[model samples]
Target: MRSMEVDMIRTLETDKAPKPLSAYAQGIEIPPGHRVVHVSGQVGVTLDGQIPADPARQHELAWENALAVLAAAGMDHTHIVDAHCYITERSHLGIYRATRDRFLKGHRPAATLLIVAGLADERLVVEVDLVAAAGAAGPAT
Candidate 1:
């Protein structure tokens, strides 16, 4: 595997593996001493418990809420090493990617997208789960 370290996280890619089709890495190597954060899947529900009917809005809110969790952990989008996004409809892929890409801000992490039959709530059309890490390696590990 070939990798380059960005913000103490290593992004993995190999000629033997197929290149990622979108803004994501083929793999991510988390170095030692990095504090790993497993964030729960954030759905479309607003802080006030509002669930937007628009799929695009749901996608946006899901990402927003997930990022908020990262912020609480003292991390940001750049610290993310992996992510999985679930969407209710195949038709929502475009908006999903747009919102994801915007929030990621050119930071590509290992990622996957799943089209699911439905979420916990019918109105919750989108959900985002993330794995993030930061901190220097070595003794800290």
Candidate 2:
């Protein structure tokens, strides 16, 4: 059978649950037979190890790095079941949401965002970590 884009994971959105402030869902359900991947914290640091001074740029790049790790695990943003993000500044919430929504396309996964005082590197403005699941996923190398 030819493969196409499918909602492999289930997003939990319900009126019974508290209304979300943004596009994130209340939760997500990963079905049996699917495998999960836990991605480490991906910061805004570039491949060349340069962290941009601009918070928006940092937020955007952090998501980009997360997407890269997902792809490496043979998954895409659609496979993401949860996203845990941290931003240094509370004012960067708008920028973080914009960047995250862009990377996630139209898929709404479970998410949690935290505003922190700082990170391991003071130059870093944002960090994104993800939990993704896919079908018959076994690349446990």
lDDT assessment of candidate 2: 0.84
The digit string of per-residue lDDT tens for model 2 on 24-97 reads 77888787888888999999988999989888889888998998988888888878888999988888888998
Model 1 residue runs over 4 Å out of place are 136-141
* TM-score of decoy 2: 0.89
How many Å off is the CA of 119 in candidate 1? 0.6
In the range 63-130, model 1's lDDT, one tens digit per residue, is 99999988888788988889999998998889988999999999999999999999898878898999
TM-score of each: 0.93, 0.89
Clashing pairs in 1: none
The 10 consecutive residues of candidate 1 with the worst lDDT sum are: 132-141
Segments of candidate 2 deviating more than 4 angstroms: 1-8, 137-141
